[model samples]
Target: MNESRVVGQVRIVGAGLLGASIGLRLRAAGVDVIVDDSSPSNLNLAIDYGAGRAARDTDDPALIVVAVPPDVTAAVVATELTAYPDALVTDVASVKVAPLAELRAAGADTLRYIGSHPLAGRERGGAISARADLFIGRPWVVTPHDDIPTAQISIIEDLVLDLGAVPVIMSAEQHDSSVALVSHVPQVVSTLLAKQLLRSTEAAISLAGQGLRDTTRIASSDPELWVQILGANSADVVPILRDFRDDLDGLLTALAAPAVPGARRAVAEVLADGNAGVARIPGKHGQDRRFSQIVVMVDDRAGELARLLTEIGGIGVNMEDLRLEHSPGAQVGLAEISVLPEVEDRLIADLEAGGWKIAGAWR
Candidate 1:
């Protein structure tokens, strides 16, 4: 393990969506990166998308990130370690415990190995979805074992930080358990809810609104990939699913007898609990709370967005994320801007005073 914080070279294996994105980020930050993928199509796509140059067998990379699926992550890491004996190795697989145990059982080199998971992704997959800034402001967990060298740990930390992510250090077991609650369990819940909607009548789904769409967004994720992630982390996931079932059973019982005081209280308490739980989730850029969403009606001309942005700048309230929804046959577009919750009213007042139409405002 080397203890130097400076990262020199990076090699990413797989050239899938995450791999390509990582390579692009490293290269954009002026770091040398080489990418390898077994699939020629994926490699070509990644290179065409400006990920990195195709990795050569002779190039001894300082850090290697394996972005393959969870099922194959262990074997791939083992082969990379053997191929590049001096390179520090890590993986972006969702589950860490199974692969770490596999590496031990297979007697692979553990000194250079660090387990990592970037808490970010889109519903879209493949190199086509690759973006250099995809990981910006996201949490990247680094799970290191006792046998790993300090140098290797530092290398992983620097690489993750350089990629514009916040590096969180934890043990492999702890990382897996934590994600099971936040990432894995929520994915399962979304899928289960989506499945219920799938079996419903067409009229039922047609009546669904934005709330349903928001809750079921993860259902659009790749089912095959999730199968591997959920299966690999089953040990941590099963207990969560069991507890979920117990809560769900209680909710269903409340629905069965709505007039019962105890059941009604339980249902109300669950909803209140959900409100509290949502308040605890870290907001954008890991802030404790999110700003209010303010909608502004924008004209659909070429310079309309620029004009709105300039107007916003004049108002002096810090703007957050922006979303645009174009209207059919209408001259205006719905521009949703996020601002500090307290500043929302001030922003609306300023924009409205400056001749900009205020569409709506919500927290």
Candidate 2:
């Protein structure tokens, strides 16, 4: 229970999705991970799910990740560091700049601390939805200060590596700004869009398609959690929202214009530019590469996907990703599996040979 000792243990100080996932991956890698949580039920559930053993007592952990809520991040990290002085403590808080500043204000050592945010999560929360591969092929951003030890930073990078995620280095300010652009702003927009439909007619809402669903999916996220995150990072997000509002005003003005030749073309050109901007987004794993999708027909019955996955396994094709979309009127659902362009033909042939139905493959 003393500092400057018990230096080989990996401790995860939250039993939520991110913390449990980290513990699960580290435990799978033969690393001894000890878990702690304010909620004893969540802590026990995480242990039951084989994430890690419950911490018998807090001591000098070798590496500690304080994966708590954004508002509590600084206070929790500061407390953990004080109690375990020799530990290299870090936090996976979504917003970094505020927490780092708060820790500094609390006189916590910056040498053994780093701020990290793994750009991955489920629509669901809690340890029940945790998975060991949650961070696999995801982007984990690390913000290391000038005073942070090189060895400590490397250890954090190594942890990201072991979790099968790509570690991207950024400063606290840069990380906050970039996340505001990509993650934080999108959540706010999605929530706003979903709120727009809250009072819509039942018929109009029922007629909604995949575009609406996809755009507003994140709006289903925990609103309370989002409030805390957005509140903490409001400095970075407000400017982005102002720019979005300007763009939206431009679109509204363009639509209000007449259907004259130049007027229509100008609006179309702006829409085309938006399309190009979207295409620039990395399809998966931030590889900056396009993916080819193959749509396969799957029945709605249980074990149907398991059977199809078995056939896919026999094909020896590596699938980059998968998305399931049920056809409204059809008896079958479309399973769009994304794979490397070169493997599409082989995947089709193998599935056909295995007596599995093929829908269509798109490049």
Candidate 3:
């Protein structure tokens, strides 16, 4: 948290993952955070965890954050605006366009409200999985509304910065469209792909590895929550999904005729296009750069991976990414650590010298 942007008080509605995480971070930064929830047990749990104390009628929050589900986001924001007349209200909902539209239709105090969506989360939910640093280095979108002044949005921007997130200003429409492609559609794709595994045999599923895990990990997310998100943004999400269906049809046709003329070329073109798409995605620190991976073999026991990481830290090499893979019947696991290309050879040299077995290294 930054001292200059130190807020006197923040009242967060909905003690779920986002709200509790915000409270945890703000409370740790010496800010007065009041966390409230419809479920008293959930509220008390967050309070007991020191995310924030129970709300008091005398509390005058400088800012209010509504972290409820997407379906009720607009209603909650409207209620917050009416209750906290002097406070600015923002939300952590996934969809922006519908909520803002609903607020306008209801004739709420629009000038004091802004819509926010932080592009960060895990497959899990609830306050138990919340962490103070969850939003660190993540993008938090602030939607532009006609009622709010350009200067008034700065308060929300400061709140984002104080949470260690990068503030990305976008219009409500742009935010909805962008997230449809990047987040909502991906959830649908992952869930549908994971559904295919339900019919697999034990032996077939035993052969699954990192690739399948990577592609379908988000399938574990709460379906109840995702239904609301996807439905709210379906206007933007459906068209992209239709495009994907067309591409898949072409791919399936090519795979069905691998020996036919031009079929192999069609398949190769699809794969090459996929490679290009991946290369366009930003890497570490949200920059377009390459990373080199160094896989180290570790005994599947306590402290082995810890020792490996401690030694990497001791060498002052920043790990851009990491992935762990362990087979059920194997005694050793592969720790794939990604670092800058420039440090690849030096890292392998240092690790091998330190008695660490190198499984592989590549860019």
Candidate 4:
């Protein structure tokens, strides 16, 4: 069966979102999984959620996944390596170099361990927020050092594949620097921008739209946890933040006298640069091709979204992406569907013919 394709048993430590998600997916594949957490309640909650069973004394695992906070990841990995001498161990910490360095310093069996980071997560934490498909179609980086054997690396890749995530092999340093630019710095920027709302009047907030919501969606993440993550990866993050600061300073100067010579051009240059940078971000299925977006208005009621999806499937158009936005007090929600540019006109015509209100289409 499918269960025999992966490791026979997986022991998950730290029953947070990542750990519990791994457990849930593994259990679905019919693999034996046991979960543990520093918090008894968290462990019980994860088990209750059907992530996995409680750890038992006689349980032997072929693989162990450490899913703790960045600060304590090294200690836990070292401890796990010592305790389960026969098991392969990996961690899902955002920062990789620090933990690897710490583990090496502690004389842990580095050969039996590899560090990994799944470039996927919601703004929320905890097992209650976990989902079995959390890593599906997401990039999961497998950080391997020179000491690790090529054959042994497959152990982690097999798990990543089983969880439906794409495995990317790289050194720990490269992973740390890459995530600093993409993940860590973005978190800092979002949190700081969201903090500005504290002084905004209710009237000012009322005018907010999808742009504000999209940019600051991750600001809802826990502060204490982010502090641990940012601090752990500050070495790579600080340089990026400094560059951002320089850009902000230049923009502030240009805004100080917008009518001055070259001021408007400077602002335009900044915006154009942003357009070029964002376009570099890969689209659906890791392709760089941009899709045409069609905004369809739907009434805010049950079965409306499902009906739309069902109709789209019947139309035989492959949707590349979908996003929903609701006006603050409006009874209608906007469904932004992204499709291939070539099919945009036909799909829009068919959708309108089917009595769907077409808000707009960007071809």
Give TM-scores for every candidate, taking all chains together and pairing residue i with residue i.
0.90, 0.90, 0.98, 0.98
Residues 1-363 of candidate 4 have per-residue lDDT tens digits of 155357667999999999999989999999899999989999999999989999889988989999999999999999999989999999999999999999989888999999999999998889999999999889999999967888779989999999988999989999999999999898889989999999999999998888899999989988888899889888999999999999999999999999999999999999999999988998875788888999999999999999999999999999899999987888999999999999999998899999999999885
Better of 2 and 3 by TM-score: 3
Residue 238, model 4: lDDT of 95
lDDT of 2: 0.86
lDDT score, residue 8, model 2? 74
For residues 1-363, could you state the per-residue lDDT of candidate 2 as single tens digits? 012212378899999999999888888777788899999999999999988897766455789999999999999998888888888888998999999999888888877789999999988998999999999889999999977778788888988888888999999999999999999999999999999997899879877766788899999999889999999899999999999898888777778875755777778878898888888888777878877888888988889988887778777877788888774665778788999998888888878787778888887
By lDDT, the candidates rank as 4, 3, 1, 2
Give me candidate 4's TM-score against the actual structure.
0.98
lDDT of 3: 0.92
Sliding window of 10 residues with minimal summed lDDT for model 3: 1-10
Q: Between candidates 2 and 4, name the one with more favorable TM-score.
A: 4
**Evaluation by lDDT, superior candidate among 2 and 3:** 3
The local lDDT score (0 to 100) that residue 106 gets in candidate 4 is 89
lDDT of 1 by residue, 256-334 (tens): 9999879889999999999899889887789897679988888888998898899888878778778766634667778
